[model samples]
Target: MSDYKAFRVELKDKIAHVAINRPDKFNAMNADFWTEIVDIFRWVDETDEVRVVVLSGVGKHFSAGIDLGMLAAGTHKYGKDVGRNAELQRRVILKLQGSINAVDNCRKPVLAAIQGYCLGGGIDLITACDMRYATVDAQLSIREVDMGLAADIGTLQRLPRIIGDGLARELAYTARTINGEEARSIGLVNRTYADHDALQAGVLEIAQEIAGKSPIAVRGTKRMLDYMRDHSIDDGLEYIATWNAAMLQSEDLRIAMTAFMNKQKPEFAD
Candidate 1:
């Protein structure tokens, strides 16, 4: 494992586990932490070695959201630091947005294993993932409203696509916590585990299942699904038609079809 203050990343057998490591601070995102997150996504995509990602946080809570100190720092606008500092504040927000985008943009599937308090910026971080699972004791919320702001990252956009506008609006407007069972019922979470250990095991099970699939098919599916999320059905049809123009001719497709016809398992080559 590499040394990182904000997070820890380890890769093995086509799976990557990313743990938010600022436990003392409830895995809070302070500027550098978000920047590191963006870098991690870029690195994973570049290496192409990781087929799936399991995201979790160290300690009691998945995350308590953005660090309070960083939020307070924005109030520095009232002081004599209005020149460069204002620009710095905007930059910080942009970087945080970029961090969320990194996760969403990764072609590999991502599974979030949440526990404890996953609030505010934590909600933003997670809405970008492909799937979410939680411990029964977990509490989740879009806490930004409680902070006098809206969820400015990927959550406000991608979340509605997953859970629909009604639930997303309710969570953002009320700033209320949702437990794992409720989260699962409402589609905010896929399932609930009895505890952290169980949650971790479940996360690994799902990640490995995804890692076992053909990378080309999985990546193409994720891309197509993301595209279809915002596009009209006609648009999606045309988009995929263009996509499959060449992909349908890949050797893997031929092998898969032949194997299926012969009642044999596929042998996809990288």
Candidate 2:
């Protein structure tokens, strides 16, 4: 709803298209990106009309990772006390983590449509999404090792879970770039498209299909999947049982059943 400096958001047919707007610098992440993303995703979470989100960049490349200038400026501020400086830097890291967590924690599914360069912090960003699709030539890397620092963002934690620990380690240790085909082979991205236009269209088609489903059912499904990640099989079953006890009573269920009997499409209210 509000204007954002780092992203351009458009909502239509219950799908939010959240695109990184800084194309000139290859859609690099700057100071505004870290802050505005939190605001944008929070809006996406609170807005009930939004059923799904398609995240992409408005450029030839997805992102070149954190802007080097911003990274340098952040390190320039230090106090005389070494412990105090460490505390300050720790807080900064936590703030950045919260930005990426916004996407991971959103109730609605966020699908990333990556193209070209998705390096360093870009890896952190996409790893947090519910699903990822990319152009065949999109180059993805865990680049912090080359920058003289380990990745402190969500990548190290989430990537291993997405692609398994062994391959995740190889990428992090070597800082090697992987194209879309290899990414799919490793299960990093769900699929690959021939080019940027096809990637956008394909991802948006998936988003639109998801948008047409019952919002309550979709949100419940996402909640269950997220819950299962840290919970045991027994716990997940119990949780879903409790969840459906209430959700199953919604009018959407009755509408869906009636539509099935009559051979008509069901329309759910926002």
- Best candidate per lDDT, number? 2
Q: Top TM-score: which candidate number?
A: 2
Q: How close to the true structure is residue 41 of candidate 2, measured as C-alpha lDDT?
A: 90
Residue-level lDDT of model 1, residues 1-270, one tens digit each, is 456779999998789899999998989888678778878888778776788999999999999988989878777665566777778767867877888889989988989999999998898888899999999889998888887877787778877888899998998899889999999998989999999999999899989777876778888889999898779999999998999897888887888788889998775654
lDDT by candidate, in order shown: 0.86, 0.95
Give the per-residue lDDT digits (tens) of candidate 2, residues 102-175: 99999999999999999999999999999999999999999999999999989999999999999999999999
Which residue segments of model 2 deviate by more than 4 Å?
A: none
Candidate 1 Cα errors over 4 Å, as ranges: 77-88, 258-267
In model 1, residue pairs whose N, Cα or C atoms come closer than 3 Å (at least 3 residues apart or on different chains), thus clashing, are none
lDDT for residue 47 in candidate 1, whole number 0-100:
71
What is the alpha-carbon lDDT for the whole of candidate 2?
Answer: 0.95
